[model samples]
Target: MARLSDQILTAIFSLQRHLLEGINETAATELAIFEQFGETEITIPALEQLQNARQRLTDPCSRL
Candidate 1:
């Protein structure tokens, strides 16, 4: 039982790490585009969507 619990905890941590990595990559890509293009009519909505996605990714509990 102890070993199973440890495995579960390890898996959870690994999943969280992967999720964070994905979030970071997404933010970086979006930021790069924004930096290169500045803000346009289209980018405004895209930026807002990105911000919301980031918030949800970092704080899934808050949404509930």
Candidate 2:
């Protein structure tokens, strides 16, 4: 069995994935779950939209 911390991380990761996938219902549920788990300070969203994943792919040798 996975360690307790690993399980918590996995659960958090799953919730974040659901949030990223536009599953709006999970946001509140996630918040409540965190609160119940004694994570009251976690008021921010689990995941956020970034400006860009990769600004642009550049060839490593091109910079030389």
Candidate 3:
């Protein structure tokens, strides 16, 4: 099975946490622009969406 490397996942999770901490609209817009081109940019349905999914997903992984 193929999956993202651990380093990649860590970076993604870290980005999620960072984004959730608070981002003004202007910064969010800039991030959205970067995501459009960034190789693993946090593509947003919005950071809240990503954060919700992150909370759900990471919980199970913690048991392993």
Best by TM-score: 1
The candidate, 1 or 3, that scores higher on lDDT is 1
Candidate 1 regions exceeding 4 Å error are 1-4, 61-64
Our tally of clashes for model 3 stands at 0
The TM-score values for the models, in the order shown, are 0.73, 0.29, 0.33
What lDDT does the true structure give each of the candidates?
A: 0.76, 0.43, 0.56
lDDT by residue (1-64, candidate 1, tens digit) is: 3455888879777778866876787698679879988789978888778878777777853332
Model 2 spans > 4 angstroms off = 1-4, 23-64
Q: Compute the lDDT of residue 7 as modeled in candidate 3.
A: 100
Clashing residue pairs, candidate 3?
none
Per-residue lDDT tens digits for candidate 3, residues 1-64, read 8999999989877866654444334355546655675533354445556456555545543532
Q: What TM-score does candidate 2 get on C-alpha atoms?
A: 0.29
RMSD values for the candidates in order, in angstroms, are 3.6, 16.4, 13.1
Sort all candidates by lDDT, best to worst.
Answer: 1, 3, 2
